[model samples]
Target: MSTASPHLQGSQSVATGPKSHPRLEIRNIHRYFDGRAVVDDVSLQIQAGQVTCLLGPSGCGKSTTLRMIAGVEMQDSGEIYVDGKLICDTMFRVPPERREIGLMFQDFALFPHLSVADNVAFGLKGSKDEKRLRVEELLQKVSLTRFIDDYPHQLSGGEQQRVALARALAPRPRIMLMDEPFSGLDNRLRDGIRDETLTLLKEEDTAVLLVTHEPEEAMRMADEIALMRGGKIVQQGAPYNVYTRPSDKASVAFFSDINVLKSQVNGALADTPFGQFLAPGIADRTDVDIVFRPQHVRIDFDRAGKGPLPTATDGVPARAVVKRARYLGHESLVEFQMDYDGSVLKVTVPRVFLPEVGRVMWLTVPRNRCFVFPA
Candidate 1:
């Protein structure tokens, strides 16, 4: 939903920029409950007009980190800053409302009794006319001007979410913290609403910290992704870098299905049924896990009961019998039983290609596509 700038009115100057100070910054954040750490030493910086997503599975402390930044929950140890000014510490703190931050949760927490306009203008600080103008401007920006007088109960789920977004942006908060804000909507509705929400946030130029378990959501909305697990951020970077160059097998598996080959390191190399992977710097006798995604596997048809010749890229060809094949909508998944040890490997091809069970094929993994890690 592209619209004119709502933050500017006639002579009022619109603040658009990467401000000198970060809009929000958390340093060495840690939160604990009952002697157990839920958020352990997490830190991130979000500049003005940028979106940073806290991405991970449920119970990975993403929500806790967002809550701490929102001033609803204080970090047991660490400092929270806004505009380079300290807003909260273990003892000192600002209240949630005074933090100049907005929050949108999964439930769309709209006031059912209040009209849409009133709900949007609830937190806005100005004269009556100014508040009404701000509400109208936001409603129009979100394409909900026609329903301004209706109550929350009368609006659809997507409309209610739009209202919530309008409310959050009406106050022009410096930073917005969202916890799975679109999870309640259907898949189709979620995508449209997410795009609209992102547009509004960009127009308003407020930093956003979104918490979600879905990897696709983070990839769509985040300028930077912070992947969390077990109460710590294991990886943080652009979505492409995080997806293509993962720090560990779990990081790779988080984005897609992976095939793992477990082996013991002997003389800095781990030998597997497929081939040997160079595990440099690994201690002798240490267990290592060689991992690759299904798409990285190349399949060759067995002709005359023979396989393709070996090459440097695909070091060795491992012959396997087709165990099962499934034709997905856009691609096909084929599982194979390796001849060396009968271990199973999965490969995905672009279009429909189905082979009967017990048919033999050669599976070769490109060395560059494989990630070697300690098991």
Candidate 2:
């Protein structure tokens, strides 16, 4: 497969839409196989020069949605529009090549027989000079101009990946579809390459829809995140909004480790070892889970075997014995056994603060940080 290429000067422009139309839009797209809905009513929009990440776990229909948008796989039902112009639907369709969409996948897929310049120029159509100029411009943009004459086998993995990126951008695609494009690189190389790729894509002013299962990748690269699950988009928002204000317990758990305290709601409140948590609107006697991340749990030294005083935000402090603690480079993860209940709760403390096992510690969960979800 060919990687997407950057736009050439004077190449045909994509169809324009009214000022209100997004750069790319999918309306209630659905795809199914073997009587199962692989992609269910997934819809999203991407503005020019923005990056939207389709984030989810494996088998969650992320790739299926990308394929449908690329026009590689037809959706069972829905419409795909570019610049408010209908490009695809059940009855009307546009060829993948004509849609001016660029594609880059996990594998670089550079042609073994071609040089870096040729590979980048593979998707270009014009005079010889025009193609060469386009390839050179893209190579320079990716910082691979020095290796233009080298073959794929001669370059390092990172270099090869840059070549793929250059080739993808060479065609000057209006929209770029990347499916785990950075997963193939080593951890050390992935971050740098990802940053570079983001810069180039943004400079080109191309709307991008990147599909990845890694939350870290989505958080780092996306301007907007579409959280997918069971073939549906569970949430869509800015990374900070989505991470800090998740819609459900599962959404909270997806981004990081969470400590859940289960309790029955009574009088719009759920009582726990920490304190009473407001669960307004939940019926009385309904089971609810109070969720908070490990990082949000504040640790305090025991005051003569007594916990700290309760506050409106921090709530009442609870005593727990440290069960285990491990230093994880940047932070230390400490597991605690609650004195009231034998349940284990994990807490992440910044830097190195490894308390010995059986050490008593006071724990408090900020009331504002806790999420009350029905069990």
Candidate 3:
């Protein structure tokens, strides 16, 4: 098997809609189980034809939030709006079927006895001619027109997911809620399916709120990402913004492997093995973590115990001995034992670079890439 590249936005480009009126708006939503807040004060907005992903780890309340929006679970507090009209709140409620919202679950949930066309047309309310026309159109859009009469069991996992998508869209819903809809598909098929599904949703002019625990999935499918943790949004932004300008050290580590150096703040600077880091907004004498991703760490040969000249971008080099190296197909991960404190640091290089375990090298982390946070 071959290694896959990271998923990014624009794998399937489509026309973007104006944000004059959000198709779906969730305001300060909260849900509790046994006095513990499971979905706490979550708020987001998704414009028509836009995809926003609620990204977090498992049990972080992403699915629960989606369920509340779908009307399967009611929020203890907060409001849900569609097209700027209040649809759900503590005092008022709207049934799931009446909300004009479509949902696609991870399992697809297709009826075993129903044909593809019938499944798509199941909830549709129209004349026989209208229902058939809508189902046929969706089938064509999903490129499953030839299997219109096939049952769910006869289709592959990816095909079943497409059929599920068609069914969710057949009613021309104003909003779509998807909960890890592509997780069941094989990894090789996931990227292609996500691109195709996103294209279809955009063309249909539906606002999409997708829930996924995978950061790569969020980056691939979301026009915007709401990074959730412990039932609250920690950060929300475009994939690039969230990935590059993280709010904290944990945020930086969430996207990829991180190398951390523990240090103490004296005055306004934190001294680490690599170099001194500007620790603004932090109190004096406080401990801080100097965080940088592996890719930002540059490794060079140790020539006569001296290394590359220090610059504004690349900080002063620190001596380290290679402990272990592993090739991860597309990239290589090397672990180094820092000579400063005998601590281990991991670095990821775009290309393969493996040296003897005991070899000594100089490592310098780019100053711009390091994020200083309170430890």
Best by lDDT: 2
Cα-based lDDT at residue 177, candidate 3: 95
**Candidates 2 and 3, the one with greater lDDT:** 2
Q: Give stretches of model 1 more than 4 Å off.
A: 1-19
**Ranking, lDDT, top scorer first:** 2, 3, 1
Q: List the residue pairs that clash in candidate 1.
A: none
Ranking by TM-score: 3, 2, 1
Q: Write the per-residue lDDT of candidate 1 for residues 1-375, one digit (tens) a residue.
A: 111112111222123354487889899999999999999999998888888889999999999999899887889999999999999998899889899999999998998889999999997888999999999999999999999999999999999999999998888899999999999998889999999999989889899999999999999998888999999999888877677667888888999999988888898778876667777777889877888899989999998888888886787888899999999999999999999887889899999989999998998988877877788
Worst ten in a row by lDDT for model 1: 1-10
Question: Tens digit of lDDT per residue, candidate 3, span 173-285?
Answer: 99999999998999999999999999999999899999998899999888998999999998888887788767777678788888888888898788877778887667889
| Candidate 3 deviant stretches above 4 angstroms | 1-19
Model 2 per-residue lDDT tens digits across residues 18-70: 47888899999999999999999999999888899999999999999999999
Q: What local lDDT score does residue 153 receive in model 2, on the 0 to 100 scale?
A: 98
Question: Global lDDT of each model?
Answer: 0.88, 0.89, 0.88
lDDT for model 1 comes to 0.88
Supply candidate 3's per-residue lDDT for 218. Answer: 90
Which candidate do you rate higher for lDDT, 1 or 3? 3
